[model samples]
Structures are given as C-alpha cells and as structure tokens.
Target: MGNYQSGDNTIQGERLSRREAVFDKMDDDSFALFYAGRRKYSSGESLFPFAVNKDFYYLTGIEQEGSSLLLSKRGGECREFLFIDPYEESKRRFYGKKLSIDEAKRLTGIPNVLLSTYLTSRLDRLLRQGLDGEEPVKKGYFDYSPELKIGPELDVKTFVNSLKVVYPDLHDLDARPLVMPLRKCKSDSEVEEIKKAAGYAKEGLLSAYSVLRPGAYLYDLGLFYEHAANSASSCSGLCHLTHIASGEEACYRDPFPGQKQAKEGEIVLLDVGAKSGQYGASICRSVPVSGRYTPHQALIYKIVLNCLRAMENLARPLISLKRINEFALDYLACECLREGLLPSKEAIYSIAYPNMVCELGLDCPEDYGELTLEEGDVIALYPGLYLSGEATAIKLKDVYLVTERGCRRLSDADIEIEDIERRFALQSK
Candidate 1:
C-alpha cells in the first residue's frame, strides 16, 4: 500500500532495542540465530509469495529471504550481525534488485552485515575462539515450533541440527519462549499499521453490505468486499478467504465463501478483512439477505451484538483472555435465557455457536494462549449463536486495542439493525 518505506530510524531503533532485550536475557558466552524464511514452491516453476518469519521480522524489519540474524553476548558486550543475500547481477536481472548490505544495515540498525555464504564460516570462527579458557559459545537460542517440522527447508531447524552434529557440547535453547512475551505487546507503530488494516476492512464490509440482496451468490458478496479492499491505496487485499454463508449454510462450522445463493428472509454471515503493511485485521458481521431482517433474525443479531459490546467495554490492561471469555459466556447465557434460546445456565455450552475472543495482530486469529490481553494488546472478540433446530447461525467479530483506560475498537462497522436496514434500503432504491 502506498510507497512502502522499509522502516524509519525510530522503527530501526526500536528493533535494535528489542534485540538488546533478547541479549540481556542470554547467559554469558551465549548466542541466538534467527532466519528469514525461504520462498515456498507452489507448483512447477512457480513459487508462493515470500512470507517472512514473524519472529525474525519482529527483531529485524528486513523481509527478504535467505537472510539471517545472529545475536551474541560475550562477557559484558553484545554483538549483532545480519547476513543477507549478496548482490548478484543475474538475480537483479531476474528478480529485480536484492537488498544491499548498506540498505540492510540502514533498515535493521545492525552494522555487521555480511553475505549469506559467510554465515557458517562466521559461526565456525566464533565456536573455535574461546576467551578466558572457556567455551566461546555455551548456549544457542532458536525459535522452535511443531509447525517448523512441516517446512524444514524454510526454518532454522536443519542448520541448528547440523551445528549440533559438529559441536556436540553446545547447548541449544528455544528462542520462542524468550521472544513470545515480547511479541504479546504491540508497539505504537505496529498498532498504527493494525488500525490502518482495520479501517480498510471496515470500508470493504460496508461495500459488501450495500450490494447484498436476495438471489446474489455468496461468492459474489465476498468479491464485493475484496474488490473494495483491493482498490484501496492502503489495502494489499483480503488477508484471508472471506467467509460468507446464507440460510442453513450459516450453521456450517468454518464456512468458506461459496456459490450458495441468498434468499429472502435468510440471514447471511460474513467474516472478512484486509492486510496493511503485513498486518491483518479480522471483522465479521451478519445481515439479512433481503433489505430488512426478519423478526427472528433481528433477535439473534441483537443478542450477539450486545455480547460483543459488553466484551469490548470490559477489555483493558491486565484483563486476561480467560476473564474476557468467562464474561462473554455469562453475558451470552443471560441474554440467551432472556430470549429463550437457552433453557438454563446449565445448557450454556450446548449452544452450537463459536464464542471465542482472540488476539489479532501480525497474524489473524493468533493462538488462544497468546491472545491474553495486557496493555497494548490488540484482540478480536467474535461471538456467535447457532440454533440447530431452526437452522440459523449469526456472529459478530471486532478487534480492540487494550489501553490504560479500557479498550478502543480498531475494527468498527455499523452492525446495528437500523444501520443495516437503512443502508440496504438506500441501495435498493
């Protein structure tokens, strides 16, 4: 979106500070290695768009592939080195210009920049050199996750494994535990990017709402949102598949936008968003297929909307996701009971609706454990209601920023019944 500047000095300074923090946690004579993921193969001769590793991108803003960051602490001094793909005329002709060492230094604030080919040599030298007659490097930290097993070629696992073979005495550590806590809170710049993404998402949803009507295919409604987002100067496109379901299809768990056609008096459920600067926004809304909601549809929509509102009001610094989830169930239970959707509090879990509030940031629907809210945490509250006997399902999803004074909504679209009816009526006229 717009002219993408790699990052500014302030951003670079922040990244450097983050690296320093990681080094501070390391024991003496310890080091850590992180890598920018490799390009993935989609099919013969074609490749998937390069997605940078979140942990690597968090410490260094460089997004290019085959790059590596090495952070080492010795005695009282910490050293940082960044190794990236070296400039090659052939690559420049085929893939455009690769990032130069000077540019990488400017972007990441790491002065020690070298070619990727030299990474092993550098590590070998470090391992061989010992100060005060002790091992030069005692512990090595890396980001390890089960997902890494799926794509060994794109991760640092192979490289670390090879190191273990040569230096059997070296201790290996998982850096995810060290970096995950740092990632939980968002910086001001990161929050701004997320907010921009949310704003673009709101525009996309509004466009989808205006054109939704009886007989429109669910896929077409999804395209309306994608088109609106793709045309924006700030939006890259829909971050994930737009979820659009109508009638009985709405009750389908994890529905994807399909060819199902809308009908009069049917409720359509949608979950969609756009990406801004690699950050994603998640927003979901429900509306009647016709210009106006039926009485029953309106009742379910209002209940879920109220649940979302209550949860948003309660979000703030120090509020754990466990607390938010408990509040949502309690509020939903009371409302469902009042509406006769549930027979009693004991039957709360029997309702077949998705009622989870998760953190949304660099990744959409991040791991639930990572969604716990603290000051500076950005989260999504998505609550749904499904009446299996009636074959009806409705949901509302929104993102919020946990601030000192509570929380502020990042994804805001008018889901109020009056607003939807008025907008749809205008479109019909």
Candidate 2:
C-alpha cells in the first residue's frame, strides 16, 4: 500500500503495513517500552485519554497500560511477544475493559503471550534456558527496565532496570538511541500523519482567529483551540497540550502554564500541535493583538519570518541538524542586531543559547555535528523575536518544515496585526 495520502484521514490496519514490517525486522532480544498513565489536570480529567507511547505502539500496536513488548528476530525467523495484565475483576470495574489474553494475541499477531505478573518468572526461566542454547532462545536484549526514573516529568528508568532482572544473561542494549535513530527519518505515511495533524491544527487556529481579541485571556484561547481540534475529528487532538500565549509571555518560552490576557499593541503567539492517527505535528504562529501590524512589530516579524524561511531553504538530506541550527542562529543574530532588538553581540549570544533552538524530543541527537538531515526529515523550525518593554511588549513566532526543495509552512494563517484585532472586535468592544 502507499505510505502517504493526499487527504486528511487516519492510517490504521493495513495502512500501517510498512511500519509493521520494519518493526518486525528489528534484531532479536531487543524490545521497546511504553507506559500510559493518568495525568492530573486542574479543571478536570485530561481532555486526552491515556496516551500510548508512540514508539511502543509503532511496534506492537498494543494500546494499554502496564504492558511490555519483546521482538525476536533470529535466523530470519521473526516472533513478536506481548506481555500484558491479565483480566482482573477490580481492574475491569475501575479502568473499563482490558484486552483478554486471546484477543491481545490475535490483535498483536503474537502467537506467544503471557500475563504481566508472570513476566519476571517466565522471562527468567526463558533467559536461562536460552543462555544454555537449549530452547532455541539465545542471547536476548531487554529494551526497557521498569526502574530508575530520570529526565523531565514522567521518567521510566526503573522500568529499564527491571529488564536486567528479566534477562540477566542477555546482552543489554541502549534501545533509546537505537529506536530514536530509526524514528528520526519519517516515512511517507508518517509524513502524511503529520500533515493530517497540521490540518486539524490549522482548523484550531481558524477557530481562535475568528474569536481572538485584545481582551481575550490565554486560557480562553486554549478552550477555543481544543474545541476546534475536537470538532474537526473525533481523534484529532488525541495527545498534546494546546499552548496559547500573548505579548511578552509568548516570548518567555514555557510561559509557566498560566493565564495571560491579550492586550492591544502586543503579539499573540500560538505554539500548538494536534495528533491524528497517533502521529503529531508541532506548529506555531503569531498575530498582533490589535489585528493590524505595527511598524515595530512588522519589522521584527519580518526578521523572525526570514530566519524561518532561511531554515526551509537549507533543510535537505545529508545535512547535520546542529549545522542547520548554527546557520539559522547566525542569521537570526545578524537580523536581531540589524533590527536593533539586541544591541550587541553579547546580547544576541545570551538569548540564542538554550531558548532559541529547542529540540522537541529525545530522538534528536545531542551534538548537531553528528546528526544529518535525511530526505523526508520532518523538522520543526521556530523563529521568534521577543521585545519586552516596561509596559507594552510583543513577541512573534512561526514554525515551518523542510521539504525536498525549500520548505512548507504548516501553520497557515494570516500574520497581519489588524486582522487579529478586528476579528475579535465584537468581543473586545
């Protein structure tokens, strides 16, 4: 089947044929881990239900919590194994229905299935037997451990440590980088999924643009965005937070996840994404709160837009990600100085260090020099300029992608300041 589609639609079943084939081709003794847990939202339960880890779902297609996967490939023979929680009366009453053992086996195409509770015991026996070269199980790799939490928010290092106990004699592999390297380059189908996400994101922007005004609060904008994403498709905003920031707060990067009201003569920034068919897009756009661009805002917007445009022109196969950022950063420095946003080299240097260039996930390489951009590389380029004034301020951001030739702007919306102001005139007045 074709890897990508021109229209916005979910890719399920046979549509994911190629990805399934590739996952099955992974080396034996190797596995990937994914954990979906409840998130605490102040208003109520999170809008999105528990999210399945993208990589884990990519391989086994098992969407459930407390589940693990093992993929074995030896002598050209492939076997997919799934470990999941067995049926429990309390669990059924609490979290709704779970996949029965037989159903999971059929759905995952895995002839072998085991209850999650028996994983440690069964895996231990299997490892010993395989280590002895008796039961056709030889040196295996445990892709994850259920211990030692690390990094931001939901760390799962402990789960990784648990792997050591399960396959004591098997070789340990760094599955994170390995899996990330494979995921770095998007296939045609993956790109199409991202495009579908972008479509819903655009719809969210349209909804926000239609009602946004100077007096609108950031939290209000968030509601508008989520509503549009939800209305577009039942599953459009499956995973991810819809971020809406205004004026100086928009320039502050994370923005502390609070409410910021829109004001005239300020920039309203929306750095948001939507998920369709489990694939996602990271798109951002900025408009003037007053709906019309001010001379000062327009000047800075042009420079930031130019930086993003430059990235689009330079992104291609075989180029390093670090090198790409360097080029973009250098252009930004020059533009910022030329526009008088940053007074000197020192000022420009400080802002670009960790704030300007952000790597979205762990998949990106730490060193830009070692990372090369491949064809069909879906890169998110955020070019922003924040000018914080004592009373009135503005910040503008725009995200784009790199195609075979130049790049495409996924966040399609008008950038004029007045359009934003007038669109919300009824609410503001």
Indicate which candidate wins on TM-score. Answer: 1
Q: Which regions of candidate 2 deviate over 4 angstroms?
A: 1-49, 73-76, 87-93, 101-106, 131-140, 144-170, 235-239, 256-259, 350-369, 390-406, 409-411, 415-429
Q: Which parts of model 1 are misplaced by more than 4 Å?
A: 1-9, 130-134, 148-155, 233-237, 352-355, 368-372
lDDT of 2 by residue, 251-274 (tens): 565553256677877777777767
TM-score of each: 0.91, 0.77
Error of 1 at 316 (Å): 2.0
- As a TM-score, model 1 comes out at 0.91
Can you give the lDDT of residue 147 in candidate 2? 36
| lDDT score of residue 367 within candidate 2 | 24
Worst 10 residues of 1 by lDDT: 1-10
lDDT of 1 at 111: 78
Q: What TM-score number comes out for model 2?
A: 0.77
